[model samples]
Target: MGVKVTGTVAAGWETVRAEFEAVVAAQPHSPEAQLAVRHHGRTVVDLWAGEDTDGETLSGVFSITKGAAHLVVALLVQDGVLEPDRPVVSYWPEFTGHGKERLTVRDLLAHRSGLINTPEGFTIEELADDAFIAARLASAEPYWEPGTAYGYHAFVIGALTGEVVRRATGRSIREIYEERVRAPYGLDLYMGLPSEAQERWKPVLEALPTPAQLEIQAAAGPMPELLPVAFNWHTDPPMDLVAYANHPLVKAQGPASAGGVGTAAGIAGMYAAAIGEVDGRPALLKPETVAEFAKLHTPGLDRVVSEPDHFGLGFERQPAVGPEAFGHCGAAGANGFADPVTGIAYGYTRRRFGFPGGPAPENLPLTAAVLKVARASS
Candidate 1:
C-alpha cells in the first residue's frame, strides 16, 4: 500500500499535491516527509506522509542550520553591528597567523576560508560543542589561501561565525535566535532542542541504497582525501553522521552548522519571516540586505565537494528554484530556500537518510511544480 499523504493545498495548488504524492510514492522507503511553502508571506501548502510523521514532527536538518546561523549574521550586518569586510582576526584576535590574517567575515560566510576540519577528526561530543570547534580552529592554517578558493567547511562554519557573533554581541547565536527570530516568530525550528520537546522529535532513519546505486558509488572510486576530513571522518572508525546527528547531546547542544532541528513548516516560516511580513511583523531583512547576501560569491568549482557548487554569503545559490533563490540543503534529503523575486519560501524535510545524500532528486520536480503553479496564480 502507498503511504497516505495528509494536508491542505490552496485552491490553485492542486498540482503541488499531485507532484508531492508522486515523489513520496517513488521513494524506496516511506519518506516520512513534510513539505511546506509560503507565497507572499502566507502558508499555501502544508503536507506530510508516512507513519509517525506530520507537519509538526521535528528531525535533524543537517546543514540547513547554516541558513539560521547566517541569518543571524545577516541581521548583525544589517544592524551595522558586524562588518563583513573586516578581518576575522579583528573580532577574534587568536585567529591570526597561518596565512589567515587576511581572512574576512565575508570569506568565512562564503566558505572560502579553507579551514574545513582538523587532520585528526573530532569526537561526536566535540562536534556538538560550537565553542570547542571554534577554539580548535582559531589557530589552524587554511588548506589554501584564505580568500583564493571555496570549500565546504562542513562542520565548523557556524563555530567560526558564531565565535564572531559572540565577540560582537556577547550572546550566543542560539540565544539571539530565540530572542529575535524563533520565539518571536513562534517557529518550531530550534538551535538547541530542549529535553521537554523530545516527544515531538522523530529520529532519522538510515539510507537504503539499491545494489545498482552502490555500484555507481563504487565506480566513482575511492573517497577523496579531503572529503573524509571535511566530513569529520578522517579518524580510524570514521564518524557515523547518522549516529552523530541522532545523539542526544548533539541535539541538545545544536551546533549551528548541522544541528538544527525543525519541521518543514518551521523552516519555511523562517524564510517567509526573512523576506516578507509574517503575522503583521515586517520582514527581518531589508531588501538591500537580502540582495547583498544572496548575490553569488562563489560561483565556480568548490575545492572540497569538487563540484560546480555556488554559494552566497551564507546560503547556497539555488538557481534551479530561481536566479535569486538562496538557501541550504541538508544531508538527509532536506532543503529550504527563499526567492525574493517570486516571493516564495519553501521547505522540505524527510526522516530518512536519502540514497545519494545532499538535496534529493525529488526537489527538482517538486519545486518546478510549485513554481509553475505560483507563477500561474500570481
Candidate 2:
C-alpha cells in the first residue's frame, strides 16, 4: 500500500504529495518513510508510509537527526551561550591535546579540525559511554593538522560538539534540546529516544553493495578514513539494522552532528521554529545567526565522502539541488533541511540503504519537485 499523504498548506502540497507518492510506490515495502514539507509556518505535506517489522510504526532516521542537533547549537549561539569562533580549548581545554590548541569551534563545526574518526577502535559500549568516548577523543591525535583542511569527522564531530555543549552549559545535549528547542516548540523529536519508542523503530531494509562496488568507491577519490565499510557494525555481536536503530551511540544526547532520532513531522516542526515563530514561540535563531549559518564556511570536496559538500556554521548550504537551499543530507538517503528564501523546510527520511557506488538516486529530485511548487505558488 502507498503512504497516505494529507496536510494543510498552500498549493505546494499537491506537488509534494505527488512526488512523495511516486517515490514510495517505486520503493514499496520499504521499512518506513516519512516526508514533511512546510512553508511559512504551515505544514503543506506531512505523510508516512510502510511500517516497522512489528507493523504500523515508523522507521528511525539516522543522520537526519543531526539537523535537529545542529539547531540546538545554533540556538545556543543565538542566546549568546556559545561562541563559534572562540578556541575550543577555551571551553574544554582538554580538547587542545596533540597540537590542537589552535582549533576553534568553527573549525570543528566546519569539519576542518582533522579529527575524523575515533582512533581507539571504539566498541558499541565505548561509543555509547560518553565519558569513555570523550576521553579517547581528548587523547587522540588529528588525522591531519587542524584547520588546514576539511574531512567529515563522521562519529567524532558528534562527540566533540556534545562535549562543548556539555562544558559550556552544565547540561546534556539532549536536555538542552528538549528544554530550549523541542518542548518550547512542542516538537516530538529526541536525540535519545526513550525505550518506549523502541517499538516504533523500523529497521533499514535495503541491502548493502557488494565488495566490488565498495572497492570502486574507495578508489574513486579522497574518502574519510573513518567512513564505515559495507559490513561495519557497532554492536558487540554485530547486530546490524536493529543496533543502528536502538544503540546507545545513536540514542544518546549527541547534538546535530549525531544521536538524533525522530519523525519527519518532528524535524519539520523544529525547522519551522527556526524559520518562523512557531505558534508565537520565539525563533530558534536570530536573523544574524541565520545569516551567519547560510554563508559558506567551507566550500570544496569533502575528504570523508569524496564529494563536493558545502558547510556554513553547522548547516550544509547550496547542495547540488539548489544554490538557495541550505540543509544537511546524510549518508545513505536521509534528507532534511530548510530554505528561508522560499520559506521551505523539508524532512524526508527512509529506511532503505543506498551506498556510494550503486546507481544511487540524486538529491536534486526532491529539491526540483519542491522548487517547482514553490515557483508556481509565487
Candidate 3:
C-alpha cells in the first residue's frame, strides 16, 4: 500500500503540498516524516507521512538541535552578556593552553577552533552528559592551529559552547532555552525530552541498506577518519541511536550536541520566533544581531566533515537557498532554518535515516517549492 500523507496547507500553497507528496513518493522505503514551515510568524505548511506519524509526533532531529543551541548564544551576544571578540578562555578558564588561549568566542562559534573531537572518544554514557563532555574537552588539544582553519565540530560543539554558557550563567543550555525560547514561544522542540512528553516521541528507524547498496558500501572501503570520530564509530558492538534517546539518562541530561527531540512544527516555530513576531511577542534577535551571526565565518574547504560549506557562528549558511537563510541540517535528514529575505522558517524531519545523511537530498525541492509560494504570496 502507498504511504498516506496527511496535513493541511494554507491557501495559495497547494503546490507545496503536491511537492511534499512528491517527496514522500520519492522515498523508496516510504519513510515516516514530518514537515512544517512558518511564514511571517504564521504557520503555512504542516504535514506528515508513514505509519504512527502525526502533526505532533516527535523525532530525534539530529543536529538541527544545534540551531536551537546557537539561538541561545545569539541571544547572549545580543544582550551584551557575551562578547564575540573575547577569548573563550575568559569565560571558562580551563579551555586555555595548547595554543588555544587566543581563540575568541567568534572563532569557536565559526568552527575555526580546530577542537573537533575529544582526545579519547566519549562513550555513549559519557556523551550523554554535557558537563562530562565539556570537562573533558576543556583540556583537549586542537587538531590544527586555532582560528587558521574551520571544520565541523560535529558531536561536541554543543558541549563546548554549552560549557561557556554554564560558566557565564549558572544554567544549562536546556534551562535557558526553556525559560527564554521554548517555554515562552510554545515551541515543541526539546533539548531535554521530559518524562511527561515521552509518549509523543516517534522512534527513529535506521535506514538499513539493501543488498546492492550494502555491496556498494563495502566496495567503497575505509570510512573517512574524521567521519568516524565525529559519529563516535563503534562496531565491536554497534550502538543504537534510537535506544540512546529512549534511555532515561540521555533524555534527562539532553546532551546539547545531538540529543534534541522535536517535531517539525516545533523546529519551524522556533525559527519563526527568531526572525519574526509570533503570538504577540517581539522577534528574538535584532537585525544587527542576525547580520552579525549570519556573516560567513567559514567560506572554503572544511577540513573536518570535508564539506565545502561550513557556517557562520553556529549556523550553516546556504547562499543558494537564500542570502539570509541560516540553519543546520541534522544527521537524520532533518533540516531547519529561517530566511530573512523571504520571511520563511522551515523544518523537515524523518524518523528513518536518509542515505549519505546531512540534510538529505529532499530539501532542495521542498525549499524551492516553499520559496516559490512565499515569493508569490508576498
Task: Give TM-scores for every candidate, taking all chains together and pairing residue i with residue i.
Answer: 0.98, 0.85, 0.95
Candidate numbers, best lDDT first, in rank order: 1, 3, 2
- What root-mean-square deviation over C-alphas does model 1 reach? 1.1
Candidate 1 lDDT by residue in tens digits, 89-164: 9999999777788999999899998889888869989999999999998888778888999988988999999999
Window of ten residues with lowest summed lDDT in model 1: 221-230
Say which prediction, candidate 2 or candidate 3, comes out ahead on lDDT. Answer: 3
For model 3, the superposed segments whose C-alpha errors exceed 4 Å read: 211-223, 234-243
| Tens-digit lDDT string for candidate 2 (1-378) | 554544444553576667666776665245256677777777777766554422124455656655666777888888889999899989997886776888888888887887665433555555555555666777577777888877666555667777888899987667777788877776657777667776665555655566876798778776444454212333355435435555655665433444566777777777778877678766667777788877777778776666575677767775654555556665446677777777777776656565652113534576678767866676
Note each model's CA RMSD in angstroms: 1.1, 3.9, 1.8
Off by over 4 Å in 2: 1-12, 28-31, 51-58, 195-199, 206-242, 252-256, 318-324, 356-363
Clashing pairs in 3: none
Question: In model 1, which residue pairs have backbone atoms overlapping below 3 Å?
Answer: none
lDDT of each residue in 1-378, candidate 3, tens digit only = 778989999998899999999989978886788889999999899999987789898778878888999999999999988899999999999997787899999998988887787546767788788888888878778888899988888778899899888999888888999999999987889998888888897777778656776787789888666666666663335455566655666666778888898999999999999999899999999988888888787878888677776798899987657667798888888899999889999999988887656787788899999999999878
Deviation of model 2 at 35, angstroms: 0.8
Clashing pairs in 2: 69-256, 70-256, 224-304
